[model samples]
Each structure stands twice: as structure tokens, then as C-alpha cells.
Target: MLSPEADAPLRAAAMTWLTVRSNDGADPLPRHELESFHFEGERVPLIDRQRGIRKPAILEAALSIITVYRAEGTTRPYEDGTGSDGLIRYKWRGLDPDHAENRALRVAMERRLPLIWFVGVAPGWFQPVFPVYVAGEEPQLNQFALAVDEVFGLVEPETHLEAQLRRYVERVTKQRLHQPVFRSTVLRAYTGRCAVCALAHRDLLDAAHIVPDSHERGEASVRNGLALCKLHHSAFDNRYLGVTPDLTVHIRQDILEEQDGPTLLHGLQRRHGQKLMVLPGPRSQYPSKELLEITYRRFLEPA
Candidate 1:
């Protein structure tokens, strides 16, 4: 187990989350307390193990959160922390996903228990790792890895391994940082209504990016997104429809002109030039005209 000092943040976060849930009269405790600073929930233990502080040669790391460094330049990746599958490998607190401590995860693929990693970025700065699951390993090549919905890899990354590792970790961190908050912000901005057809079903609503998350100018901000329904979101992504910077809806000319069913005509094509069904408040919180133009222009592009 890690020292009390290093494990403080995760313990606090877990306890706070549990307390908040319990206070709301939801699941009481939400977690089973095994001891002080130790808890269990979601069928896994939230162990707080120090990155390199060995606990007398045996430790529990499965289903836990770990901090990389105790301080700046103090990160101790367990010696022999990486095993390459000739082409790729993974580093998890110097232990691979296949380590004995993580045996349950391997045994129960459906559980998809998440490993929440924390990196001591600087002397007191820590960042949470995106929750990732153990994807299988290349035993012959000795590589183990992680993923979100799909497996991770370094597809022609930086030549320097350290630089590549930094970028890789940052990529996951950025993804984690962007998604939930961006989704929540954009959804709340439009009051959970689909901007195209005014669909008010929260479950049917999604926060769609004006510019995709992969675009260079893309941002995970309220101003760079729209609240959309699943069907319209697919249409918007597939170029069947679009919205102007001024928030006017526009159906593709091809779709508008084509003779089709009511679902295609009354549902979409006829809606061109209509005012957007929803817009965010505070004026300053409104979508960015510039980002809207980027997608709007794409809407006008041929093919």
C-alpha cells in the first residue's frame, strides 16, 4: 500500500463521491469500507498504491488508482516496468496489465474494471489518467496494453520513446478531460434540446462538436458544440444537414431535391433555413460563430 500522504487525493475523491451519493439518499455509502482509506465498489477495490514504493515485496494493485511520482522528478517506474511485444508494450506503474494483481480483470473481460491512474506532474500537481481497460496482451512479444473502447497503440509516434510516451499519455488525458465536461456543458447550454428539431428527450440528446474532436481547431467548449439528437447528429456528421454560423438550419440540396419518404422530406429536407431549435444562454456562452463557420463551410463543400 502507498503512504497516507501520497494516497490522500484519491481517498478524498472516493470518500467525497460516496458521501455525496449517500447524502442524496441514493445508494448508502456507494462503497464498502474495508478500512480507513480503503474502499470497494463497482466490484473492484480502489487501491492507492505509490508508483515505486514497494510494500515489502508484495502489493495489491488490481483495480486501483496509482500516482506516478511522489514529487517532481521523483517518479519511479518499477525497474523492468515495460515488456515489449516486439512492436509495442505498455507501462502501468511499472507493472503490465497482466500482472498477477490484475488477474481478476483478465479473467472477467466483461467487467471492464477501470484503472484510474494519477501522475504527479510536478511537485504537488497531479493529473488523473483517463479510465482505461486492460485489452489482451501479446504474450509471445511480452506486451500488455490499455484502451477506451478500442485498443491503444503508437502508430508511428515520435522517434524518442520518452517523447512518444509523453504524447501517448497526454492523448488519453486530453480525451478524458474533453469528453464528459464538454458533453455536460453543451447539453445544459441548449437545455437538453436537439438544436435541429427541438427534441427534448435528454436520453436522445447528445453534445455534438461543430468541428470534430480530431480537428486541429476543435475544442471541448460550449461555444464549439451543439445539442443534437442521435438521428440528426448522424445526419450532420454524414453531411445530410448542417447549421450556419447564424444558427440557421440547412438541409443538403441533394437531400432536399431528392424525392423520398416523409422521414426524409418532412423530417429533414423541408427544415432548411429554419431558425435553430435551441440556443444556449448568457449570450457569452453561445456557440462560437467562427467554429460554426468551419462546419458550415464543410456543409457547403462538394462531397
Candidate 2:
């Protein structure tokens, strides 16, 4: 059922399918139409459009894996070109192209010697098939094969596939999973101003997640974060400080009475209370009001 010789074309088709499917605000092609499409080069027809939506079994399976990976925020699909009415080309970019996983994908596709490891998807919604290789002396069939098969089985069966795939694409392309990058973006967006102190300082700034990273259901994104200085980030994380939806800073009353808390109390309470920081452009991307409400409640309670 599997042929190494067929791997290259299959992989190309699959990548193309995945790219088109993940495009935001775009319509997918009917499977029937996809079957009739022709691929350039290679005398053997890559897809049998005459079969009328009965795509190659392997192609369907490969699509499922691509969908899942896109959902996991590991990669992103982008439009490569546009010309034909209501049609578009697509491509993919992984977070770390130099990583072994991406390299393996390149080799399996037989793209080129020291292959670029990336490709563009043609117009259409049909799923594409590709080959996968497992490195081992004994051919570890269970791990590699089972993983691929599981993805294949999920292609059209999952109810939330579209929504999950969208979120995943944004996550991967934006590098949301990389905390440092996420943090830095938020900080840069705020121009290094502390959300609490309103003091702009390049050296002391940090991007703080309103909901701690551990509590974030998905990758830490700008939507769930804020820009704070080192002192404020630590204070906020420790529940010694909080911020309101209006961006006002709140220092816990109990901590203010401590014998050694004068410096913190004076610096935060007298100087910064009720004063709001100037948020960067696009308030929509700022920490959500709902998230701030939850964070404030936790900050007010006993730690």
C-alpha cells in the first residue's frame, strides 16, 4: 500500500491541501472538483479527479495529520498567490524550520538535495498524500505508522476541526508558544511601559501574562498578557499587586501595612494608584477585561 517512489508527489499534494484548508476567511473546494484537477509534470496523474471526490486513501490520511499539526500551533498555512477568481495558492512555515521534524518532512517530500523543506500549495481544497520516514535499525512501525494513521482517521470526523485549526495557525505563525517571543512582542507593543507604574523603562520591562502561563489553555498569546517592569511582574505574580480593566494599578491593602513594605507601598500606592498606563495601539489585543477580572479576584484573595 505504501511506495517510496510515490512519496514525493503525494507529500506535495498533501502540503498543498493543508495550506488551502487552513486559509482564513477562504472557501474550500468541493472534493469532486479537486479530483478533476491536473498537476504539472510527471506523466502519472497525481490525483484522479474523475473518481469524483473519492480521493486517494493516503491523501485523506495525510490531510488529517496536517490539520492536527495546524491545530497544535506547530505550523501556519499562508496564501502563496492569487489570480483565478475565487482561487488561491497556499504555503506553510513551521516555527523552527531548522528543527529535525521539519527536515524530516523535507526529505520525505524528496524536494531537492538539501531541500528547502517548504513548498507552495496550488488552488483547490482536495487533501494531499505524502510519505513519512522513521529512523531506526528495526523500522519502528508502531510509533510512526500509528501516529500518521490516527491523524488520517480524524480529517473530516472532528466537529471542531475548523475552529481549532484557525487558532492553531495563528499560534504557530505568531510563535505564541515561545514565551520569550510572546513576551517581547507584548512589551514592544507597549514600548516598555509598565502597565501598573506607567513608568517607561527599557531595562526593567517584562511581558507578564495576566493568567499565568501554566493556566493558559493554549499558547501564551498577546491577548492574555500585559507589559510590566520586573518589579511589577514579580509583585503581580505574587499577588502583591493587581491591575484593573481600566489599566489602573492596585496594591493589596494587607501588604501595605507590613513593617518592611514601605518602599513597595510608597512606590506603588502613593505614586501610582488610579493612574493608568498609555496602552499601545489596538486595544483589542490588550489583555481582555474578562481575564483582568479573574486576575484581580485572585490578587485580592489570600495567597
Candidate 3:
């Protein structure tokens, strides 16, 4: 808990820190960075160590809420889930809606205060989403409705502009909530190595989609992704490099003939016709051949 005068400043400082981190491309912030947040020479934890809801001793509303990730087939402490209406459903701390933690959340809802939601992407990593509001509450269900965008706090959409805004919000919410998890899962499957070049640096690797997300079949599943280094990811995206359904690497003819430096020769041209340097240990985690065929055909087409 912080003094009344310090509370607002601390929250503002946390938000600024989060913005800086995001601008620096630190998605799915690690636990160490979250714990290291300091305001006025004091360490103020943005996340609670044991509780779902975090609030100070003061009578102000809740500061934030979190949803921890449990491994597949394991039991979860809360029944939190996304609603059919496209809003986030956050479960109460206990059955009683008036419990201190729960009440703090409700107060945040009534006051329309923005909050940070640290969604666990992996065991110790989290994706920080900010300025999300507790837009609505359902006492009977012992839960609250969270709006990823402020427009959700407005009345139901009745106009074309409002309808478009609603669609945008839904898309943004889905990306913010799902993208980090997808990256973590894909990277884990490949053991944090680039499948193309066998690079082992997790920070320099990306989960490249075999088929782009805009396509109807481009689901965010491990089977539709490949862990690639930044350089290879760009080449794959630009069609300079293509991987066939049989898992052979192909460099575009123009790229192979280019008179570039060692990077072009050793990094890409040499990998041509070679089998992927790394693959997921689990056979079921392999990239989907059908999707690869589609992507490979697109690569063969004139860009």
C-alpha cells in the first residue's frame, strides 16, 4: 500500500514504464522487469505475488488483475475466459462479491479507471495490457466484464462508424491476448532455436507463420508456425527463401545469383536445398504440410 499522494504517481509511473518497454519491443515482458519497477526510489510491485486482484490499503479502486496460465490438462484456480460477446470474463476472488479484493475491482468498474492486466504467456513470462477497464459486472455469475477498448463502455453500436469501431476493438483484443501466447508456444516447441539456421538465441527468433494470419486457415497453432531467426524470417516473408512441404529450404534464384557479401552467401544461399536445421522434438508439433504447400506455391508465384 502507498500513501494517498503516492498512489496516483506510482500508477502513472508504471504506465510510463510499460509504454517505454513496449516501444523498446519487449513483448511478453519477463518477470524480472515487472518486479524491478521503481517509483520515487521505492519498489512498487505492479503485480501481486499470490492474489489475482491487487489494490492498496487506501479506499481507492483496484490497481490491476491477472490471469495465470496453467499447463494443458491441468486445473486452473479461476474460471476466467473470453465471453461470446468478445469481452473478457474475470472471475471474482471468492464467492462473495463484496470481499475486499472483489469490492476493489467493482469500485474500479464504477469509477471507470484503467488497469493493467498481466496475462501469463509462459510459466514466468507475462504480456502486459494496459488501460483496460472493468466495463461491466455480473454479480450473479461472480464475475466482471472487461473491455479491451474504451468504446465498449459506450452504449451498444447502432451506427456504421460504431459498428466498425466495435469490430476493430474485437480484433485488437484478440491480437493482444492471443499473439504472445502463440509466440511462446511455438518457440517452446522448437526449443527456442531457429528451425532454418539452428540459431539458439530466443530473443532473435520469431514464430513465423507458414500461412499468414489474414488467411482463413491461418490459425495461431504450433502446426502452422516455424521458429526462425530474424534474418530468415524476413527472407521467408519476402519470398527470398521458401520451405517446401518436404522440409527442404529453397532460395530464390535471383537471391542466389546476387553479388552480395558473406551474409547473403553463407546466411541464405548455402542453406538452399538443405533440410531444416532444427525441428520440434514432437512429431505432432511439425508444421502442417498442407499449409506449407499453399505457402510454397505463393512463394513460387511472381511477387
Candidate 4:
């Protein structure tokens, strides 16, 4: 087997190869003849004895290091006195190494470390790597390769690739949840109909988050959304209106009792009460009952 130190160059080579393949949408160059692949306008020298060097093991280690750099935004030298050069020179090291970090790294490599690293680096990349299995002759590309491309192309050597990767993942995964995406999902869910009045007018529709975005753990998944018109979403968020745990609409009694309440209540009760905008999909992704309950209780509180 190749010494860990000797593997570093191979790891770098693999990353370069994967990046080239992805950019060109082509198959990776053959492993034994990898030196035929150009990197930075130059061909890397081939190892004299390919049999003695384990390409996958080298790739896995490189992937692990890249992943950690992407996730932690820092380079940590291996604990066994091995330097931060991407090679694990210690042949006697156990598979289940005693080091916590090393163990974590190993786990990440064997069990979709690239996916997790990609999620931290670029969540939109998740869709490509997801379901982990595909129905075709092409082998699934390693998910880490996505982040590796970004790191090699965009990141500074000293910069933590992990932090950048995390930012990318967050950006892509949540892209649809921004004002535009949020609005689109909501509008689509409602089919351009108002949640309150059943008013099927495109111009009047609004997409509203059932749970405020700030409180959400994941990016705005479709289930956490609703389609209301401008007035209802405003009133709903301001606690002037609320949805029941069962998704029924309710106008707050206090709002009805305020000055100008007669006009507001008359409009709301006539248009919205006892009705729900039927969600587009199965209720599983619909606003959670627990979330509705929490919003309802907050609305009912003496403020």
C-alpha cells in the first residue's frame, strides 16, 4: 500500500480529475492512466507502480480531509504525529483509530461523508447525490467532488473550505424559500386562490409561512407554507387572525372588539371564517398541528 504521505498527490490528482469531469460532463480519466489528465495546464507524473498504490483509499483520505476542511474551515493535523499533508503514513494505525476526530473522519468517508460534506458546502448539490442510488449504468459520482470543485476553484488555501461549503449548501437549499421562492410555492399551492375568500385571482394571492421563517429549523419546505392574500397574511402574522390546530380559520375576538373592529370583523367573518385553503399535497408536509397550536396560543395570549 502507498504510504499516507505518498497518497497526498494522488488525492489532489483525483480532485482535479473529478472537477474536470464535472465541468465537462464526461467520464473520469482511467485511474491507471490518470497522468494523461491535465491539471493546471500540466500532466501529473504517474506513480511507477500503480498496484502498490491504493487509489480508492487515497481518494477516500483526500475526501475525508477535504470534507473536514469544508466543514470545520480548518486543517487539523492527524493526531498520530502525521502532518497535514493528506497522507496517513502510519501503516499500523487501526481502522477504528483511537482519535475521536480520526474516527469521525473515517465514518464520514465510508458512510456518505461526501454527501454530508456537500450538504455543509452546497445543499442544492443534495438533490444530485440524494436517494444515493440511481437507475443506470453510470456509477454515482462522489458527492464530495462537488465541494472539492468549489474548494479548488474558489477558496483560498488558508480559508476553511467547510465554512464556504456550508454557506453554499445553505444558499442553494434555501434558494427557493427566499421571497420569490416562498411566494411561488405559496401561489402554486393555492392555485392562485385566496385562502380566506376563495378568491381565485392571481394578483391578489400571497404566499405566507405558517411558522415564521426565523423559527424554522430547515429551509422553508413546502409543508410550512400557506396561500393567503395580502390582507389575510398580514392579519394572520399580526395575530389579528389565526388558524386552528385543525387548519380552520379564526378571527381573534380581541381584534374584532377593537375600534374599526366592526368593519374588519364583518369583512373577515363573511370571507374567511370556518374555511381553509385546501393544501396542494398530502397533509404530511402541510403546516404541523403543533406549530398551528403554538401560533394559536400566542395569538390568544394577553398582549
Task: After superposing candidate 1 on the true structure, give the runs of residues whose Cα lies further than 4 Å from its correct spot.
Answer: 1-167
Q: Which candidate is the best by TM-score?
A: 3
lDDT of 4: 0.44
lDDT of 1 by residue, 1-303 (tens): 444343334434554544453332111111133123333322224333332211212223233443343321233553223223212234333345555534443432344444543333223323343345555544444434555433344422223456566556556544553455466557766877998898998778778889987798886667788889998999999989988878888988888889978888877977888988778766766778999898989989997
Better candidate by TM-score, 2 or 4:
2
Choose 1 or 4, whichever is better by TM-score.
1
- Please list the residue runs of candidate 2 whose C-alpha ends up more than 4 Å from where it truly belongs after superposition: 1-105, 108-177, 216-219, 259-262
lDDT per residue (tens digit) for residues 113-209 in model 2: 1111111121233223322121111122111211122122332211344656534433333331234345545665576687666678666777788
Candidate 3 C-alpha lDDT tens digits along 69-183: 6654455789777665667789999898779899899888877777888877567777687777887887778888887655456533222345566666667766665676678
State every prediction's TM-score relative to the real structure: 0.51, 0.45, 0.75, 0.43
lDDT of 3 at 241: 96
> If ranked by TM-score, best first, what sequence of candidates would result?
3, 1, 2, 4
Error of 1 at 290 (Å): 0.9
Which runs of model 4 end up more than 4 angstroms from their true locations? 1-141, 144-179, 259-263, 269-273
Comparing 2 and 4 on lDDT, the stronger one:
2
Can you write out model 4's per-residue Cα lDDT over 232-288, one digit (the tens) per residue?
878888887888887788777766556666657565654446758566554444666
Q: Estimate the overall C-alpha local distance difference test score of candidate 3.
A: 0.80
How much does candidate 2 score in TM-score? Answer: 0.45
What total of clashing residue pairs does each candidate reach? 1, 6, 0, 14
For model 2, give the RMSD to the true fold.
15.6
